[model samples]
Target: MTHEEKKKEESHGRPEIPAWMRAVAEVISAPGYERWARQVAATGGCSAPVRLVGESQVIDAGTGEVLHIYRTADEPTGHLLVACGNRRGAVCPACSHIYQRDVFHLIRSGLSGGKGVPEAVREHPRVFATLTAPSFGAVHTQRERNGKTLVCRPRRGGGVCGHGVPERCGARHDGADIRVGQPICPDCYDYAGAVLWQAHAGRLWHRFTLELRRQLARRAGMSRRRFDALVRVSFAKVAEYQRRGLVHFHAVIRLDGPGGHDDPPPGWATAQLLADAVPEAAGLVQVLSPDPGNGQRVLAWGDQIDVRAIVVRGDGGGLSDEAVAGYIAKYASKGAESSGTIDRRLSCGRCKGVGTVTMARGPAVCKRCGGVGTAGGLDLDRLPVTEHARRMIRTCWDLGGRPELEELRLRPWAHMLGFRGHFATKSRRYSVTLSTLRQDRAEHKTAESRQRNGLPGPESTEVLAHWRFAGQGYTEAQEILAGHISQRAITARRIEEQRREGA
Candidate 1:
C-alpha cells in the first residue's frame, strides 16, 4: 500500500479526525491540489496570510489591449493570499528573514558600496559604537578584570538584602545562567524606573546626536551652526533589548562632506577623530525623566561604551564592516520577544464581552486586554497574566495620562512597554530604503511573470487591480502543513545565508 494509504489505515481505530483536518485532507486530495499548493507556497507558507478578495486586469497602456484578466473566485481557495509582512521573527520568520537580508544590504551599501552608494564611503570616517543603558540595580553578572574569569559577586559577611535575596553569588555563574540579568532581589529592582527609561530612550539618542555634532564642531574650531555648513554626520542605528530588558543602541556613525556621500569629508575627519568624539559626546549628553512628580533624575549612557574603527580590507583597529553589518541586521527583526514579552499588541478583549472598548471615532480598545486599538481606560487588574508585563503596562497607562508626557504617547504603545521608536532606523542618505527594495523586487517578479507568459513589459502594460482584506491564518490541518512548509523555508534561507558568507 502507498504510504498515505498505510498511514490512514493505521489511524482507523484512532479518535475521529477533526473537521478542519478532514477539510485539509480533502483539499490536498482534490484534482487541482498541485495548483492550490503552489499558490499557497507563493506566500512562503505564512501561518497567518492576509486573504484578499478582488479582481485585476492587466492592460496594454499604449494599445489598450487586455493582456490578462484575473478574478479572486478563480483562485485555488477563492481568495488571494498575501504575506503578512511582519518584521518580528516571533511573528513571521519568513518575512523577518527577508527583512534581515534587506537591512544587511542597506547597512553594507553604506559601508562598502552598492545600490548607487559610492565606494568612497568606505574611506569616510566611520565608527561602530555601542551605547548601553545605565545600571538599574545590582544584577547577577559575570565579570573579567583582565583575561581571567572573576567571581560573579563577592561579599565579606555574605549578608542578605532587605528582600532576603543573597548579596553575593559565590558560584562561578556561566553566561547562560537564568539569573544573569535578573535582579539579585526582584523587590530591590527598580522596575518602574527601567520602564520609564525605555520610554525616554529615543530622546536620549536624539540628545546624543546633538552632543556628538557639538563635539565635532569644537574639535574643528567652529561653531555648531558653522560645522553644519561644512559637513553632515550620518548614522544608522538599531536598538537591542538586553537580558535586563533595557534597550541599548548600536550605531554606524559616519561623517561626510556637505554634499553627503558624493563629496569627501574634510582632512580633519578621520576614523580616530570620530572614535575620540564618541565617548566625549556620550559623557556630555543627558535627559531628565519627565518631572517624575517625585524628584530630579538624570539619565545618561552606562559605563560600558564601545567605539571601534571600521577599516576595510587590510588595516584593522576594531570590527570589520561585514561583522558590523551582520550584527545590526541580525537584531533588526527581533522585538519584545527577547524580553519575555508580547511582540504583537494586546487589547481589552481578554475580558471577553466586558463590553467592547469604544474608540474615539469607533469602538474603544482596552490596549493590554485586547479590546480594540484604543487604550485609554484599561484596569491594571484586567491586563495579561504576567505580573512583569502588567506592571510595565500600568506604567504606560499611568505615565501616558500625565500632561507633560502626553507627547510621548505612552498609552498607545503600552504594549511595547512605553518605547514607541522603530527597532531600526537610518539617516536620510544611509542607503536605499526597505520600501525601495521591496518595490524593485515586485517589479522583478512582474517581469519574470510577463516573460513566462510572453507578454510585453510594464512600460507598455499596466495592471489595474482591486483587493480587499478577507481573513487570516489557517485551519488546524492547514496550520500543521504550514508549519512544515515554514520549516523548509527556514532551512532554505539559512543555506542561502551560509552560502553568501562562504563566498
Candidate 2:
C-alpha cells in the first residue's frame, strides 16, 4: 500500500475517540465557543465541556412581548465551558482543576480572611487535625525512611491462622506493591465490620462534633446553648481513604466569637483550650447501635486521633491557610473511584452478566489466586476486596435503605456508602462559605468578561443570559482542538502570574 493509503487505513482503524474527548471537541467547535475552546485546548483537552442545545426566550419588559428566541445555533450552544459538576478525574480533568481551585480559594478565604471573612481570623487559634478509624485488622504495609526498609507486618514465628493461612507477611513491600490492598489473611480482617463502619462514619463524625461542642461548653462553665452565644466553633473537614481502605478525616477547626464573623471571641477562647477539648471530646464520644444486625456496636474515634495548633508562623507550625485550603480542595474533587471502586452504578443485570462471563461456562480460576471454582464467589481470597471496590459496594448498599434510614441517605454519594458529608465541610463561623466564594468568583468572571468585551460597567442597564444543559462531553476532532486550547490557556495564565510577580 502507498504511504497515504497506509495513513488512511491507520486513521480509519484508529480507536474510537474517547467519549470524554468527543464531548469536549463538540463544545469547542460549537457556536460562540472561541473563549471556551481556548480554555479546553489550554487544559490539553482533558475536559469535555457540557453543551446546552436549547432556546432562550427574551421578553420586552414594557410590552410583555417575546423579543427574541435564542437558539443553540444562534447563541453559544456548544461552547467549550467547564462542566460544573463532573467529579471524576477520568471524565473531566479541566473541570476538576477548576473545582479544586475553587475549593482552595474557599478554604483559604476562611483561613486568611477574604470573601468577607475578617483578616484577623489569621490570628485565631486553629488546628489541622486528622481523625482516624479504629483498627479493623492488620494488613500489609510498606514503610521506608532514609534507605531503611521496614518489615511489612512482623508477627511472631511466621505463624498460621485458624484457616491455616500465613498469619504475617515477611516480604518488604515497596511503595508500588500490588498486594498492598490485599489482606495478609482475609479471614482475620473484619470485612463486615469495616463495611458497617463506613456506613456509619458520617454519623460518627456528627456525634464527635457535637461532643466537642458540649465539652467546650462544659469546660467554659456554661450551658451548651449558652456557649453558642459566647463562642462559636468553626471547622472544615475532608474524608480521606487510608491504605487500609478505611475512611478517615482531616479537619481544620477554629474557635470564633459569637455572632459569627463580626464578633470577637471571649478572652477564654484559646488554642490550648480547644486542643484539650478535641481529644477529650473525641475520647468521650461514642455512637451506639441500639439494634445492630447481629449485636449492638459501639463506634468511637480511633486512639490515633491527632490535634495540633495551627500556628500562622513558627517551628512545628501547622498547615498554612493556603495549604489547608489547597489540600481540602484537592480531595473534594475525588470520589470513591479514587479508592478503586466503579465510578458508575452496576445494574443488577450487569452484575449478573459479569458473573456469568466469569462463572457460567465452568468454574474459572480466581483472578487473585489461580484457584478454580472461585471466580464468582465473595471470598476475599479469590476476589480480594480492593479498598476502592469495597467502599463502592458499601456506599451503594447503604444508599438503599428503608424509611427509618432515609435520614441517613446520601443520594449523590450513594456510590461512597452512607457517608454523604461534603468533601470539605466548614463550620458556619470558621471562614467564608463555599457559596459566597463561588459567587465572588462568578462576579469576577462577569466583570472580566465585561472588561474584555469593552462593555459598559456598573452604570449600564441590566444584562441577562440564560443557560440549559445541552449535553455533556466531545468528539475526537474537537478533543484535539480542546487540548491545544487548554495548553495555551495554562501557559498564558502562568505567564500572567510570572509577570505580576516580576512587577
Candidate 3:
C-alpha cells in the first residue's frame, strides 16, 4: 500500500499511540539505528549531546600523503555526537558521573601517590579540614551525640525575638526534614549579612590560606620568607551548599617541601601541627564586604571547625585516602539545588529579563522583578524557593543594585545564592589536573581508534580537522532511548564489578 493508504488503514478502529512511542518506533526501524545507538553509547548516554558536522583528514607529514579521512556525511546519521561535559549532576547525570570519577582519581592520586606522583609523598603531613560560614540567624538543625539524635536549639526559658517569633526550637529533626535549614524567625534573620558573607566567601578563603601559612611559620619560629622557602602548602577543596543556602569548604590540606609534593616536607612539619594551625587560621581570617548602603560587615568562618588527620587506613580514627577522595568527589557534582533553589537562571516573566517593559502608563521598572530581572521579582513569597533561600536571593538582588557592590556581580549569581566561585579547586601542585586527565583519555581513545582502523601512528601522521556546531540535546524519543542506554551501561558495569569481586 501507499504511505498515505497505510496510515489511513492503521487509523481504523485502533487506539492511537503516544507521539513519543511512535517516534521511538521510527528510530528503531530506521536504517541508521545501529550507528545512532553506537554513537549514543559512546557518549555514555549524555542527556544533551552536541551534534557536529565535520570532516577530518589524517595525512603523512613527511610525504604529504592522506592516510585516512573522516566525514560526517559518510556516517549513517549526518552528524558526529559529542558528550556535553557539564559537571552539574542536575544538568547532566551521565557526564557528571564521569566527571566525579575523574575527580576521585585526581584527589586520590595526590593522597596515595599515583598517576606520576611519588609514593613517598604519602608521608607528607595532611589533614581533612572543613571551613564553615558564620551563622546569620538561628535555624532548625539536626544534631547527634553517641549515635542518638538531639533536639535542635533548646532554650532554658521561652524567649521571643524583636519580631515576636520564638527564638528556639526544641523538637528533634530528621535528616530529610524540609524545615531543617529554615530560620526559626525569618524576620529576625540577618539576610543582608548572610548575602554579604556569601559574596565574600572566596576572599575569606584566600585570607584564611594566608593566615594558615603565617600560623605554621609562627609555630616553627621562623620568618614568613624563611618558612616559605622551607615548606609549601597544597590543597584540594570542594565547596558544598549546606541546607542553609550557604557554602562550606571541605579541603584536604597537605604540607610539602618548598619544591612541592616531589620534595620531602620539613622535619618539623607534621599532621598534628597542620591540624592545629587550621583552626587558629580559620578563627583569625576575615574579609570585609563592599558597603551596600548598609554598614560594612566582617565575614569570617563559623565557630565550628573540623580538622582530622588523614591516614592510609581508617583503623586509627582517621579518614582514609579513598574515603576522603570519594567524599569530596560526591559533592563536586552538586550545587545550590540541595537548598531548594532552581538550577537554571530565572528571568522576569513580565519584563522578560530586560529590566523594564512598556506598560499602559509608560515604560517603567518591572514591578514583578523590582527591575532586577529575576522571576517573582519583589514578591519572593510566590517563588518556589524555600523561605530562607528566598530571603538570601532577595538580599542578593538588593545588594547587587548598589554601585559599590557592582564588581561582585551578585545578580548574575543570585541563583547560586550570591556565591560565584568555582565549586572544586586545588593548589598548583596538589595533584594531576582534570584537564591533563581528560587529555590523556582523549589521546588513549584516539590511539585505540587508530589501532582498530589499522591507521598510521600520530608521530608519522598529521591531523587536520574542521567542525561546526549542528545542534544540541535530544527529542523526547531520543531522550528515552538514551536513558535506557545509560541504565544498561550502568548495569553492565555493576555486573562486571560483581564478577571481578567474585573472581
Candidate 4:
C-alpha cells in the first residue's frame, strides 16, 4: 500500500503507527498474525535480533525418518531472529533483562544452593563484601545519623581556605543535587591518584583474595599449600560505578570444602573467620607502581570496606541471601552504564603514533578516516563533567605518554578512567555459569517445541543445519514491532518480580 493510503487507513479506524512501522503493523493487521508475532516475541523484542539464514531437520536415529523440519526461509522475516544479548540495559533493555535473570539465578543458586550447587553450601560461611575507591577529596555526600540529616562538610565561620572553594555547605544535600560527587575543590582533588587507582582496582582485588587465603592459613597455623588442600574460597563479583565515576566491587564470597561447594568446609573454617580476614587483607593489600609524575605510591582501598554475613533464609543474623543476590544481579546487567564514565575509548589514539597530532579544524573531523588520531575536539572538553572525572581522564591521557606505564595503556582507556577489566567475574566453583544456564534453557525450549508440535525430540534423530551470519538489527518496521514486544516483556518481568516479592 502507498504511504498516504496507509496513513489514511490508520487514521480511519486503527491507531496510527509510524510510517517506518507501517510494514510491521500491516503484518500484525494481516491474517495468521499470531504465529508471526510469536516468532518475534520469542526473542522478547530484542532491539537488534540477529538475522540468520539456516535450515534444520530432526531425523529418527533408529528409523532414519525425518520427524520435523524447519528453515529460516519459511520465517516471517525470511530469517531467524535471536537476541542481541547486550548486557547493558542502556544498549538493549530486553537483552539486559534476560541477562539479569540469568545472573540472579546464578547468584541465588550459589547463595542458597540450586542449579547444581549443593544445599550444604548454605551451611558454609559467606559474606557480602563491598570494595570502594579511596577518597580523592571531600565530595558532597548524603550522610544521616539516627534518621537525622546532618550538615554536609560543616565548617566553622564559613571558612574558605586553599583553592578558594567553599569549605563547607550546611545544606543537607539531596539526591537531585548536581554537585553530589563533584569534588569540593577540584584543584585539591587527587585526580591522577583516582585514575591510577582505577587501573589497579582489579589487581587490588586479586591481591586481597590472595592475602585472604594466606591470612586464613596463618590463623590456622598451617602452610598456604596445606590450607588450599583443606578448604577452598569461591566468590562472584560485579563492578558498579559510583557517582564519582570510579568503580567499586560488590562480591559474594563463600567458603567451601577442598572438593568444592558440594562438600562442607573444614570444621575450623567459619564465616566469622572470613569476615575478620577481609579487613586485614584490605588494609595490607596494596598495588605498588611508580606514580605518573612522582616516584612511588601505594594504592589501597577506601576506609569504608563493608563485610557482612549473608543469611540464607530469615534475616535474624544479617542481610538475606535473596537481597544480596538480587542486588548483585541488578548491577550485573548495568555493564558500567553511568554518567561521566565513557563506555568506549576515544578515537584520537588511532593515529599512527603520539609523535604527530592531527588538529580538528572548522567542521568536526568525523573520527572515521580523515580524523584518525586528530586532536582539538571540544566535545569532551565542553561537557559539564565533574572536575574530578575530567582530570582523571586527562591523567589517563597524560600517563599514556609515559613509557614506564605503557602496560596500563592509559590513553586508550581514558574514557573508562583507566579501568580495563570485566564488569562481572566469578571464581571457579562459584555456581553454574551463564553459558551453562543458557544451554540448559535452550535444550528445555527445544524439548518443549518438540512436544508442542508432536514431533520426535532431537534424541530420536540427528538434527543438522547450515547457518550463516546474515546480519544484525531490524528494519525500521521490525524495530517498531520489536520495541512493542520488548516493552511488554519488560512489563511481564517486572510483574514476575513483584509477584515473587509478594510471595
- Top model number, TM-score: 3
The 10-residue segment of model 2 with minimum total lDDT is 347-356
lDDT of 3: 0.87
TM of each candidate vs. truth: 0.87, 0.76, 0.90, 0.84
lDDT of 4 by residue, 355-457 (tens): 3445665445445435434234435454455566677777777777788887887776777778888888889888999999999989988889888979876
Arranged by lDDT with the best first, the candidates are 3, 4, 1, 2
Best by lDDT: 3
Q: What is the RMSD of candidate 4?
A: 5.5
Alpha-carbon deviation at 119 in model 3, angstroms:
0.6
Residue-level lDDT tens digits of model 2 in 1-503: 99999888889957887877767766656666775555455333455666665455545555555544545555343343444456556556656666666667667766788777778887777887888888777777787778998878778878887778887787898877767756677777765566556667887888888999999999988899999888888888878766666688888888888776566678888888899899888898777643335556677778998887776754455666666777777777776655555455332322321222266787553444233212233342222346535544544444343334344433333445435555667676766666776677678776886677555453433444676665666566665665667666656765775697499
- lDDT for position 88 in model 1: 85
Q: Which segments of model 3 are wrong by more than 4 Å?
A: 1-14, 347-383, 493-503
Give the runs in model 1 whose Cα sits over 4 Å from its true position: 1-24, 142-150, 348-390, 401-403, 493-503
Computed on alpha carbons, the lDDT of every model, listed in order, comes to 0.79, 0.65, 0.87, 0.80
3 against 4, candidate with superior TM-score: 3
Candidate 1 lDDT over 18-76, as tens digits, reads 88778878767877667656666778656677889999989999888898988988876
Model 2 TM: 0.76
